[model samples]
Target: MVRAAGKHTSARLVLICVGLLGIALIADFLWASSSSSRFALIGANWAPPVSLLTPITIPNKGVDSQKNNTTTGRVLSATFADLPAPELKWEKMAAAPVPRLDGAAMQIKNLLYVFAGYGTIDYVHSHVDIYNFSDNTWGGRFDMPKEMAHSHLGMVTDGRYIYIVNGQYGPQCRGPTSHTFTLDTETKKWQNMPPLPVPRYAPATQLWRGRLHVMGGSKENRHTPAVDHWSLAVKDGKALEKEWRTEVPIPKGGPHRASIVYNDRLYVMGGQEGDFMAKPGSPIFKCSRRNEVVYGDVYMLDDEMKWKVLPPMPKPDSHIEFAWALVDNSVIIVGGTTEKHPITKKMVLVGEMFQFNFDTLNWSVIGKLPFRVKTTLVGFWKGWLYFTSGQRDKGPEDPAPKKVIGELWRTKLNLGS
Candidate 1:
């Protein structure tokens, strides 16, 4: 994996120029779609503020020596180190082609699936990219079915199909689409699913047991994000063979990001209370001065759908979030900026990655991610966590400073008990 620190001096300039361009492009695409089945990208807030990118180089890693690193007979195990804590080096297995930033990624079997993300403010892409670990090739990109841009799209795999949920669409997220679609892994074909009840973006979804559980996100008409959760059971992927039912509300409040399933429970991290939180605006709606605060704090839900608080995160917190599965009952999360931005009055970038172990009920810092990107897809591939273009926007932080990293990064996760 790659690692690097940002030049604090150039950060402000990048925010304004890049952010404006992104906003303009999103507006242009919302009114149109590609002649092909392809779609356009929906940007997250302005742009991912000053991404903390450490592009992990894959070939440089001695993949040949990895066989000895496997302590538990699990192939490709990783040892995480806190930059300064230990000399724990992450061995890169493979890499992604056309390095895309602020895009979405999902791992099914050894295949990593990538989708929509903003290449720049005015340049949202609807390319469907994929990477196969078994073959180590990154081609096989199919076009998305609609013009859906704006980051923070909820993604989950129902063990059979991959689902892309709602986010901002049409002219910088001016008009919204309750549109839902699924990707047939076998045929690589796109099929539309039922639209969300309310058009919302940056919502959280969990694939548990046999259900696709969707949590709160910012609403279209109202500024308030919801705490109400919906559960869908897929029979053949047409309609929700089973309807949506309510699950537990976020203990702290409504509108949460990064709702992931681990050890029979759903865990959520930082997120703000506003539409397209990736842009500039006040993120506090259902929040208290404290809890409303973008929190690094972690919360949990049991199989019974009960809520409980775990350990709090190492602060300055974030408003957006992404999650992936890990060893044991653990899960890993990346990105989400501080509770507030340094200049534009919006949360810029935190460049933080963390992991939660269900058995231990503990949180640990993994490693710093590369700069200049948001998380669209953060999934497990082989034994490493593969991250793709991740972007989103909430309030009015426009030109919506936007940034897109045209690359992919991977790191090894130490999934030991």
Candidate 2:
């Protein structure tokens, strides 16, 4: 009886072990099937089959659209889709004729025109340089009617002519001017147009519907701000001899903001309300107080002629003095400075790049540049972005020399579906 009982106990133990193994196998098979189906649904439309058990490591070639061949029997149908993202390729082009900062650049046909700003040795300049895309060369140097240099000057083009509006000229921000000029690309001549109603520096300006609209800037030195908006009335398809008519003012006008017209709507972004810089030994500078207010608010002018505030920009503190250009319904903003440092009181340069989609109302970071930059001349032409001379560092003081950049950079913009 004892032997029979012992044998019965052993049999029962073997049966329990087999039952656990069968249960585990069933659970694993069910999990694998579900995972494979989910991945197939997500990736079958675009990517090849893959296995979930095998890890995927994307190579550093360019984009992640290539397929992975590693597989496991349990997860044979798992795969990943190629996401829609911007593919960028940056290359160094020919250097500019002169090194400068805070200049304006515009593109017409196959030519890129760059206007005056602060040169490396001079406080201001009236020089103009042209880049020919056909030959990939820089030539056609001309001079403006007067010296123009400031942190923020408004410039636009209508394919035949380039218009420049109010800006400052001096070693310091002491000479705010209301002067406006237009350059005839065919004649290579600068002609005086109606000046702005108010003398301001860094006012946002754009050309829309046969009229030039100007708004917001520093009124009289970089201390006081202006919120006025004016549009030049067109006569006989020309803006000559036309007076500026007052329109709806911007809700929160500031200096050095970027203004652009896209799809018949005006959009403005990034500026400061107060003095951007203070004297090195001043109380505000020494104490490292946040005297200047950098804004990240984005405003748009609708068809009704009313200003509608859009979603605020991301990374508000570091959105000042960046260069902006529109490419295929997307707004691209590159490189700017952050607020003053608490201890050193110096502004920090941010090298981040971002793109805003108009249809989706979303902002995404594209990539960082090779170096930090601000007040750079940027324009998009024929699927390539041209960035010219700009300042890599703040202006020098006393014995130190100013560091101006002279290289031209070109990048191919690849939009993926």
Candidate 3:
């Protein structure tokens, strides 16, 4: 009888061991499948170090409390705002040659030049797609110089020339590169410029007072914010200085922020403090979301080279470093990533068209977009506000988007009521 009891116990132990082994095998298979699928999509040989389903580790603090307190209390919304219709509609135009995020766009007369961006999961694009506004068609495509970084680039144009600054090179959150280049729109030629002393990811770059000023972007680690402000003397698409000169650092340092020169004053607005970081010991630089603090804080570099706090945006916005247009006396911003939802804690994307009136020193929600999207390239031409190429959400409520689109949409700029 004792022997029989012992045999039953042995059988139970064997079954439990087999069950545990089965569970382990399933987990391993799922991880491998996830890694292989990403590799297959990007046609890369390296394996992913982190699973895409890994939960992001956010701090206990709420996102609404993330704004810079120094600048939050000074500004108020305009009492008599010029608001567009809630159901404002847009008309679709030509589709982009490549749908992308993290790309840059510049309108040179009748032509819109779109730069390199992330085309697919882990795939970085290195081509320029040109859209002609004269005939409303995609005119041509051209390859970027091989030295150019594929994504997270800082691009700005001076009428006939487009200048690209330091950005993330290659794919999968790779290290930032110091390479800089300029493209002549008239000749369609590329020229290498003096590299940045410190490469930064998505720095706010603009031409101000005959110098290319670059400020506030993530450091080489892909997460640390950089406050190192530098400028190089440039004239007529040529670098006049051999090295960048140090300038006054921004009060808030981060990337994916908008910087523009209005009335000869530099305004930097709407950026986040934290960004994705690569896992330690990752061979392929597998990326994961870090604890981020998005802000609507706006800072201005006055003529005296001093930083001044300005009115913040209507909400904490980011991913809009290049998604802005200077329309008349106001700066118009399209879609971008906003703070996470309060209840669900999921990331939220901005759908409304926002305008910051330089005349009134106020902000107003001017219009609503067709849908919520992020990383869109915007241009204003002939009274039309055009946006193209970005990731789109499933619906108004859904924060996660499964599709990237190249469809161009436009609305009349004068339709504000």
Model-by-model lDDT, in order?
Answer: 0.55, 0.66, 0.79
Give me the runs in candidate 2 sitting further than 4 Å from their true place.
1-89, 147-151, 235-237, 276-290, 317-322, 393-402
How many Å off is the CA of 72 in candidate 1?
32
Better of 1 and 2 by lDDT: 2
**TM-scores vs. true structure, each candidate:** 0.65, 0.71, 0.79
The best candidate by TM-score is 3
Predicted candidate 3 versus true structure: per-residue lDDT over 14-85, tens digit per residue: 999999999999999999899668535432311222221222223344433224323221111111011222
Cα misplacement distance, residue 9 of candidate 3 (Å)? 47
A best-first ranking of the candidates according to their lDDT comes to 3, 2, 1
Name the TM-score of candidate 1. 0.65
* Candidate 1 local lDDT, residue 400: 25
Worst 10 residues of 2 by lDDT: 73-82
Best by lDDT: 3
Tell me the number of clashing residue pairs for each predicted model: 65, 0, 0
Clashes of 2: 0
* Superposed model 1: Cα runs more than 4 Å off: 1-102, 147-150, 221-223, 240-243, 252-256, 275-293, 316-323, 341-346, 370-373, 390-403, 415-417
User: What lDDT does model 1 reach?
Assistant: 0.55
